[model samples]
Target: MTQQIQQAIAKLEETMRSIGVLDFSGEVQLLEWSKSTSRDGPKIKFMMQDDDSVLPFEVATVKKGKMAGQIYHVFAIRVDDLPIKTNESEIIALEPAAKQPNRLAQAMHTDGYFRNSKLWTGMEIAEAYSQLDHKSYVEKLPCCGTKFAKHIACNGDVVGHHVKTSANSGIRIKPPHWYLVPLCHNHHMTWAHGSHAGSATHEDRHDLLLPHAVALTANQMKVKAKKIMGISSLSEITIELLDAFEEEIFGEAGNKYEDFK
Candidate 1:
């Protein structure tokens, strides 16, 4: 295995430990490197194993340029291939959406709503803009921005980007709502997948970004609590409330946000 793949697996193991998916003794093993048929790029595959359990995953590696030799995407792969059971009659006699066009349209609309709910609304995202400006933040950083500096906007759609993309170890799950921070579209895209040619990518930089997201989200919650509860003073925003939010959003490892300024 290459040094980059080994390092990526080590970091993945650390994440598992933090989330209690694995104990300190648990280790991740690289299974193989295979070519992706569609993208024609090499994929590094690994699995987390302890005494009795093994969970497999694969990450796409950046193939060229400054970001080359870095793990780009890490995703879980279910090793078990349990056969799915289905009723043949029910499958063959499925109801057509054309029979209930209104219901189908309604379902589509509701799905859209659910999709949008994955991220905080633009208004909620704007709350953290004052305390933590993502534009200025990413502009000064090397991992997320450089060439796109000229195109970065001061006023545009700010998204509620999650610090932790997934809820569990390498599994694809949406993170809790409260783990989001206000980040501009440019920075968000840059970090996730480089937005422009020759732009920087995530490449182990989530460590630098996650803490900032946690801190800003906590502060934004405090401000929100002050406004909604009619608390006259920022000092009046109780620590208990922030603690509860952190525990709900950040799980067990959330940082102290009361003095995040």
Candidate 2:
């Protein structure tokens, strides 16, 4: 290794020691810096040893500082290959940048929604939520939300039920979907995967509600119209009754069916 690489390794070793990490034997190599599309700023790869495991990491956004005429660099490292300790005590000092706004920090904040608290693996939670029923109530839903819906509908065999906390806390609510309105499996999946997934595709306000326009079919629309007319069946409506009902109920509300059609 060159002098710069040697210096980096020595710094990492010292960092490990300062953070109370033990058994710190590893190899460090200086890699070409590259920007991350999935995260903030530039990154470099670092390899380390961890008790029968070879840990690889992407050190993001290295910041250089000069102290007493000596130059020092701090690296924002992500444990890419495995789950490392993320507790405040274990991580806060090593990654103070985590306290700032960034994608990694946002992901860490929302991780509880995607990952299982007990197993601490994405696969485990994916499997569990995949079997959930899509049309069920939110309170009764298991990890019930758009995220669960995507896991069950597109990628797997399960359906997600919507759920909101009663007091807005804990998993006590049994059927989450009951509280939420029904959404098609596709739209539900999209919303669960990302925040931008369900937002309007175009810049216009009219375009924002486009998904609602195309959501129902002609048959579904007719059924909805029939319900609003308080008619038991579609055949019960006369032209005169339709006109009067349209003026009374639908004229002011606008033609929602027209948008769907």
Candidate 3:
């Protein structure tokens, strides 16, 4: 494998460890490569989809001038054969709108979520996530992955996470869309809202955050999207990852304390 391909593969391999995906091996196929111009000058981007035709882990490399970096990113909605959110029969896939409150809860509602009440409007629920986000591992649930819309109006509160795409770090070119990574309330409230954690090192907590998956997937989509749109700044795209934790718990948007009580 070429160094570029090796880098992409290596990143994919490490990312799969977090996503709990199967190893990708045998025949690292060349899917697509395109030449484009950004402020950074001439660039080449290659993309691949997980079709089950190949193993799940492979690197995607982006080259700019002489400098290069390997980034691993993921998308919540399963594309083609991706193991999560791709189910056609599921309510999230069939209804198309069951994305926010989370497809997992919808899929499990009949089995007894929301206290078996089923009062959910398919909208996102806050308390349901309290137990999940506290764990050290990054939130892996598709429903809780990330949430954002192009030109999403902000209420100014940190609602979700956005993957990094800086010229030096991940995406040299500004990504064209706003995204919401499903981050833990703790990370959002404690670290983001205030200062870093005490006992655990910042690097240690950072090792546990959402990484290249979302941003890289955005690049893959940009390949196919091929539409002219404004690119988001690196600072704008960087809220997705963090390396701190605190005891004070923040709350999610559109949540009612009375309901949870």
Candidate 4:
């Protein structure tokens, strides 16, 4: 390892040393997939786990129970400050620019938490909130609103129900505002999940909400959104920058959607 990399490992080791210890928890540490790996490149792994929880353990494949794969170099979190220890002999504290993909220097919502399912990664839900219509999200829908409709006056009791979810309560990720609205749990669970009748569907919500979620995340108002989306030193986020990330991740679909637009 280069002197620079050794120094980074030393810093992270020091940080890990200082944090309080807890019961066994998972972590994402750096690895060298091959000797040719660049100094900036560290093979990230979700690390192994054995319990009711996984720091999103397993790996390959996708969906409900578990898939199998490793994770990589993301930063530490202020909350849930678990004891920091590593099994890996080599972990690098790359510069912020070279840290890892997504500038994931710090942990995002799903960085090291065990998820209930893998049918789809938490990644989709993490970004799903951004693809919604912010103005229509609140102004138009008092009770319920889909991509096509704006806020409709509540015919019944309404509360902020998150747009993204399935029947599985265990399956959830942080949602951005405009991603949530005044709707009963029935709408959040039953209606959107296709378990009931509504003009929009869970699938529709997923698809419709995605592009707008991409755009809408740029407008994350909630503190939770700010943390999960990694907004710091700013209140509002740039739609264009996030859009570019969407374009990079989603290709053309990241730009916009038809029914949603």
Q: Which candidate wins on TM-score?
A: 1
Give the per-residue lDDT of model 1 (tens digit) for 141-252. 2332222233443244556655564441255765554444444566666643466664434633355445444443443333343334444233233445434533443343
Write one digit per residue (lDDT tens) for candidate 4, span 107-188: 2222321111220123345453332434344433333332223222224444455555444223455554434544544444
Report the lDDT tens digits of candidate 2 across residue range 151-239: 33433333432333333236554532212333444545554333564432333112322222112112223333344466534335444
lDDT for 134 (candidate 3): 19
lDDT order, best first, reads 1, 4, 2, 3
Report the poorest 10 consecutive residues by lDDT, candidate 3.
239-248
Candidate topping lDDT: 1
Candidate 4 CA-lDDT value: 0.36
- CA shift of 123, model 1, Å: 18
Clash counts for the predictions, in order? 0, 24, 17, 36
RMSD of each: 18.6, 26.0, 20.2, 19.6
**For residues 1-261, could you state the per-residue lDDT of candidate 3 as single tens digits?**
356766776576557644544323223222333455564444323232222222122222233344244444433222233243455432222222221332322332233322211212111132322212312122332212122111222232334444333421354553222223433454444443435443223442343232333332332222111111122111111111110000111222222222222
- The worst-scoring run of ten residues by lDDT in candidate 4 lies at 112-121
Q: Model 1, residue 232: displacement in angstroms?
A: 2.5
Greater-TM-score candidate between 2 and 3: 3
Cα lDDT, all candidates: 0.39, 0.33, 0.29, 0.36
